[model samples]
Target: MPNSTKRGRRILAAGARTIGRGIVRTVTRSDAGAHWARVGGDWYETLGELKGAAMKLGQLASQYHDVLPPELSKQLARLQADAAPLPWERIREVLDGQWSAHQWQLIAEIEHAPLASASIGQVHVATLRDGRKVAVKVRYPGVAAAMDADINNLGRMLRMAGILPFDGDSLKAVLEEVRERMAEEMDYQREREHL
Candidate 1:
């Protein structure tokens, strides 16, 4: 289990490195690297695969694109929520865990593909048996653990590279706040109720 976890981290780090390089390349040449990080033929799919703090950072960057360089802004603005969906089998498993089999059947048509994907969850368009159109948001399993590990790894790397502006304690506090917000975002029920 420990070995598998380490392997997963290494894979994720490699992906992040690829994304960082792609960002640099895109900045250097506007059109050359437009499709630098694509998944399922969509740029947003690549962002979804990152699935943690990295995704959040990308979303934030996109939101503030007006303040960014044109090249960077363009690339970040393409960070939509349409991600490669999980398999129907996996979706069924999650549904089974969240609702009874009969309740699951009441969903007339849950899109096999996700309509939108973010850091913690993906959204699907569905129609209920009662003929109501609803958006179903499902949280990804183990996202919190993955996100925490990745953030910690990034902070350590940045500090070691002398790139961080603040001291370790201050940085930790900031990370704690970020983690709390991410935790809130992960709660689908809470979000639904708020909406």
Candidate 2:
């Protein structure tokens, strides 16, 4: 088979495995003399679990709704903002790391629960001591580490599955991009400065 064909098959297999294992339900279709299987589920959570390239793929799939079954498209559309909020304790811990106890006390009120949660962070509504309302964004627990592991594993998996062309220069460029992004993301202080 051609390299592109092999790569396409590998991508499909990876996507199928990801969908099958994540929050999905199996659907069956039957004709007068034939049967077929379909899969459907919470696209958002499935994409979130896949993360990185897989999540990007899901988003891309959503764009081509005419080519995808309704169930698949609907699920992928749901992924636009599908995630559970992190617990309040986790939020507090992150805040504690960023603020002193006195500083926390200066905040008149902070929502115990997050107002919203996404793959990387959660947002909380807070009132400062001066009676100013603010929104706090707390990065999810170990997200940087998880992202690193996921990216590295995905790269290895792509290489092993022959999904990535074996070009050393291309791979080096990819790794450099990953490293730059990861480094920036891992620095809370830098993020604060950027904000």
Candidate 3:
């Protein structure tokens, strides 16, 4: 995960380029397809690397092809729920922190590779010393801080760029919902209960 400042710049820079391109495209009356594709690529690269609220928003937005440009939606769809998994070293750090020494010792074997990867966490299959297999979901490091910065920055960036279709009230409502969902997703206990 990037430090907050670097992440902020990455997202803001993408939004700035998108705004600049939109302006030029509007004035030139050029084909929108390729222009939109480049815009989508910028967003995809930025959000995929960040892997937080904005990326989640992009993934959901990808489904609404009628509302979003097809090219943009296409790129967003690439940031699927099963995003690129983090390496074992990163996952091990979380496990080391969360599990007691006794709990850690119970694992006879654990796969470094994840069965699934999401914005918040990933599931790895582990075998207990007693020979029972279980799936463990480990939260990514720095996700809470990343989500916090992302939520704070994304709306302002979009509004400043004049990119969102909604007005202030509507945008506020949308952002509130994003916040709520982010909260829900981050709560591991709640997720387990719901499941």
Candidate 4:
């Protein structure tokens, strides 16, 4: 089989596993059995694997302990600290595209390894031409392209799981809010200006 075909099959299988885990989680209430713990573990693993808007949504949802069951909130909160970091090659691609040779010349040193990583981007420790240490956040390439599809898929999953309101208006508003915040976060120039 072609490499692309194998990659596609792998992606699909991973997605199916996540969706199955989600279903199990949503159906298993804390009072039902100790199986909820397994559900939580599955959820954590799935969200860690899917480190984009899906993970972001999980982190956001975890904040609403008052609205969600304490057990569920605890499970989702795990996503906040746990996410798969982008590969070094992917991180390098973003840095290379953003900084030209002239710009890179100004940097005294840049750590190849990430200092911190989140859903939208990762931060690296860098010493500038001025010898001031700073943290540089590099947005993952293709995150913008994948953002919409990921959000929509997550929304559908949440709605189906009865975590999000089924009402169209409320769901629309929630999704819009997520999109706006994600867009702002991706805007490095805007973030720099704010900083």
Better lDDT candidate (2, 4) = 4
- Top model by TM-score, which number? 3
lDDT of each: 0.59, 0.56, 0.82, 0.69
RMSD of 1: 6.0
TM-score for each of the candidates: 0.63, 0.57, 0.92, 0.77
lDDT of 4: 0.69
RMSD of each: 6.0, 9.1, 1.7, 4.5
lDDT of 4 at 185: 82
lDDT of 1 by residue, 4-83 (tens): 26625654554565466556656876443343333112323444565566456445545544544444445555555434
Off by over 4 Å in 4: 1-33
Supply candidate 1's per-residue lDDT for 174.
Answer: 60
List where candidate 1 sits over 4 angstroms from the true fold: 1-8, 11-48, 58-84, 162-170
Candidate 3 Cα lDDT to native? 0.82
User: Among all windows of ten consecutive residues in candidate 3, which has the lowest summed lDDT?
Assistant: 157-166
Error of 1 at 180 (Å): 1.3
lDDT of 3 by residue, 1-195 (tens): 787788788888888898899999999998898888888888887887788787787776677677777888787788885387789999998889889999988999999989999876789999999999999988778787888688768888878876556788887787788888988888888988998
Candidate 2 ranges with C-alpha deviation above 4 Å: 1-73, 155-195
Query: Alpha carbon lDDT of residue 52, candidate 4?
Result: 57
